[model samples]
Target: MQSSIIIADDHPLILKGLNDFLLEKKYNVLASAVNGKDALELIETHKPEIAILDIQMPYYTGLEIAEKCKALNYQTKIVLITFEKDEAIYKQAKSLGVYGYVLKEFALTEIEQCIDTVSKDIPYFSPELLSYLEVESTPKELETLTPTEKEVLKHIAQNKTAKEIGDLMFISNRTVEKHKSHIIKKLNLAPIQNSLLIWAKENQTLLE
Candidate 1:
């Protein structure tokens, strides 16, 4: 039987390209969607054999859609397409039980291979991304911090504001500020909010 597939991405060109390519390959393009919400709707309506999902979207992330599919007991094979090669996202995708994770920069031929592999009940990772995993080294150390400081860092990573974190931890606002100061000093991070967020996301697995 021909495989039925749905393509989801925010870019019109990407959606069209995938649709045309798959159609030419003799696969049935069951539906296409621009975001996670629409993708989930298409999946439920069509029950396609495969779903090709872009990781970044406006309404909800591809990972969110994957989780929903899992919850609904959908048996469709999922292929996540991403521009990012972040380890945290990679680990999260694996945890979501995705059949394949394809980097956006790979050739169309690679995509074909991924689809075929996933359809055959095998997992696939794009070659470029696989190489990244092979070469990444574990961090040696994070500067030692008190348990309270670690909690503060975790809350910050979760996007909590200083006052909000203070309320959550039942600590005074002055205490929160002091903890933040100490964290910056200990980590020697750049004195920028975005820099801190970047550090948090990049080192999330280490924190865990």
Candidate 2:
């Protein structure tokens, strides 16, 4: 049986493009909407097998609608399309159990696969999205370090000894050791011998 699909996007061009593409591929596109409210209404009325929604829409965002569907125990699987590469948004989508997440840039190229994967009761995410998240996540985790800790990490990345780092930074060796301990804790290192050093070396490029 052909899966029933409902698509929603605020931009007319995107909505039409996606709808037309699905139609061209011989998929059953049940309905299309221009806003989140209308989209939600269609879902309630039609209860499609899959819903492809733009993340940002009037009245309610895609994430919100997905949450509502989950709350109401709908059988519809949601696939969110967005331009956002934000960590928080992606995390929220995963938490809501959204079936698919496709970036706007890759929507046309990836949507077919996304729908296919979701119809099989599997989750799909843009490959670029995962790479972007990995790159963005490092900077955020690095942000948790204090300025002093960052500098200590940089020195460690350079293979500086505690005494050498202390001399260069004009702090006492004891103080440098204290900073290293704090850095290890902040970075969640295993506290095994040379674990901090290994992490520092592996992430040296990011440290710079």
Enumerate residue pairs that collide in model 1: none
Q: Model 1 residue 76 lDDT?
A: 84
**On residues 91-157, what C-alpha lDDT tens digit does candidate 1 reach at each position?**
8987898888998878376888888767777678786785576358443225577888878878877
**TM-scores, one per candidate:** 0.64, 0.66
Residue 136 displacement (Å), model 2: 3.2
| Candidate 2 C-alpha lDDT tens digits along 1-208 | 7889999999999899988999999999999999999999999999999999999999989999999999999999999999999899998998898989999999989998898878877678897897777665674457899888889999999989999999999999999999989888877655568978977876777877
Looking at model 1, residue 166 earns an lDDT score of 90
Best by lDDT: 2
Whole-model Cα lDDT of every candidate shown, in order: 0.81, 0.90
C-alpha root-mean-square deviation, candidate 1: 15.0
Q: How much is the lDDT of residue 54 in candidate 1? A: 96
